[model samples]
Target chain A: MTPASPAEPTNPPLTRRARRRNQLVAVTGLVLVWVLLWGSFTWANLIGGLLVAVVLLTVFPLPPVTFAGRIRPVPLARFWSRFLRDLVVASVQIAWLALRFGHTPRSAIIAVPLRVNTDLNLTLTAEALSLVPGSLILEADRRTGTLYVHVLGVRTLDEVQRFRRDVLDLEARIVAAIGSSEERRRVTGADPAGPPEPTRLEGTPT
Target chain B: MTLDAVLDIVAAGCLIAGALLSLAAGVALIRFPDLLSRMHAAAKPQVLGLLLVLLGCALRLRTGVDITTLVLVGVFQLATAPVAAHMVGRVAYPHDEIRRDLLLTDELAAHIDRIRADRTDRPEVSDAASAPGRG
Candidate 1:
């Protein structure tokens, strides 16, 4: 079997403006970490963090992580609210499953074909799924943008379809929030259509 | 009761719940059947538990300094945990650690096969087709 090629460029050169922005973002994050470690946000800590951040950025310049999408606040807000609600719901579901102890929860790994092909979209969707209690991404085929996710409590095919639809819904929300116009159109266009066809391999029964 | 007393009770509840969730995570890690399933146990509750504990600590401390640190801890944990779990899951799949019977579909295998055929059809592109992190 051939392995999946890495989607990310190893060291793609960044534009001058992009480089500056990357450095600024990194510095800001580092400075925040510094202040947190110091357990204060006084002038002294802020100044110290700033100096350290600048020095760190200058000394060790990292390859720029390119995001081909811009943030749309409305969609972003929608995503967050829905995510928060799902987090609570999933946690309660897991807690119930844990408490039930007697019944063996039937779990299955379902392959979901992703329409959103960008690295950022794929990564975000996987992270979101993994954060939720019931599902976790087992493997991602970068070649086809397919995610193999192990989901708890899927006994029937209908439940499997529902899980797949949930993933697609999340991807749509994410694309709407930060994806480019082309990505947004693709997602929107595919909405009326059914779920993307996923490649299936027969599993041998134990 | 007074506001401070009420806050203290809420914080205590958060801490207790967080601790219990973490305890449940440990149990699931051992009790789950296979590698991928166990990873769900390993990743989810642990993160939520940590977030709750951090929230409790932040509420109890209430100062600018302690709260900042707690916020940082929660943010970083939320950002990093899923990525780590993804990496673990990715590694487990190629190694056949996941139970085959438990998987309803194996799209990854199909994708790999397609890639292999495509590579075989064009020998010159083999170098480019060679996936990173695998021999």
Candidate 2:
């Protein structure tokens, strides 16, 4: 479901070697999950997990493993630290909102258009945004790369715009951590990929 | 305190903090007006709460396999919670349960077909939805 040629017109297809590498990565990750689930590192668990991973891969036919970028350690570490902080903040904020007496929290449904319109970027950003406390993704437009976020406890237009900018900044951090140079450049406003165009289809009045 | 005592004390604190977060989620479930806001309560605080509980469990247990299992639970929660929330939110979005009144702005309304609120929809949401944001 990633950049089906026209979406990533400039991108090249993955070669056989690259495809193999992707499969290996997937299998390894699955195996790790399986082993972790079992809670032990026995031969049986290892073998069983491998068998399951292989079967699952064969059945599912791995989606485009189109990670054309390298992981930057510094940004990745920063991203993790920032993420944990956000997580704590989100939890505390939610807890406070829940406990505060007689205060009905105002919410909003703000649609944020992502700078990096790739499927992976959309998925990752949506995942991160939703996991954060105040924000939830109601709908994501894959074609135009927009996330309709349901935010809790916002009081004004400025806050809504601030949330939008925060979403973009989050996208920038994600791209910095794992996106390609081209993708990173796009987020930073260099060679604009330009999909924030709210180009929706036939949205009618309520 | 001795080292083990200190670890146990910290573990107890983690457990208490985690339980407090869970309590917050429970309070949120009752107090949050609409279905969507309740979903935020259901998903967000509980995740951190569960992770804290697991961390406490690991520190107290100090066993390899058990810690690994706890880690697995945390991983699964982190991975699946948002996805579950998204699916539920998508379904809830088109329904009358999502209080458009309490919503300061519905920018999503402009981009998609807004479902007209059926006056005789679910009573719980209708009552809560009518309850103006007292804040």
Top candidate (lDDT): 2
Candidate 2: regions farther than 4 A off = A1-13, A190-206, B113-135
* Tens-place lDDT digits, model 1, residues A1-206: 33222222222344567656767888889988998888866899999999998887666655345565689999999998888777766666666666666755677767776676655677889988887758988676555666778788677767887888888889889999998787788777845545555644455333
Native contacts retained by candidate 1? 0.42
User: Pairing residues by index, what is the TM-score of model 2?
Assistant: 0.85
Model 1 residue B11 CA deviation in Å: 0.9
lDDT of 2 at B52: 95
Q: Score the docking of each candidate (DockQ).
A: 0.33, 0.29
- How well does candidate 1 match the true structure in TM-score terms? 0.82
For residues A66-110, what per-residue lDDT tens digits would candidate 2 score against the true structure?
677889999999988888888889989999998999899998887
Q: Is the docking of candidate 1 incorrect, acceptable, medium or high quality?
A: acceptable
Model 1 chain A: weakest 10-residue lDDT segment is A3-12
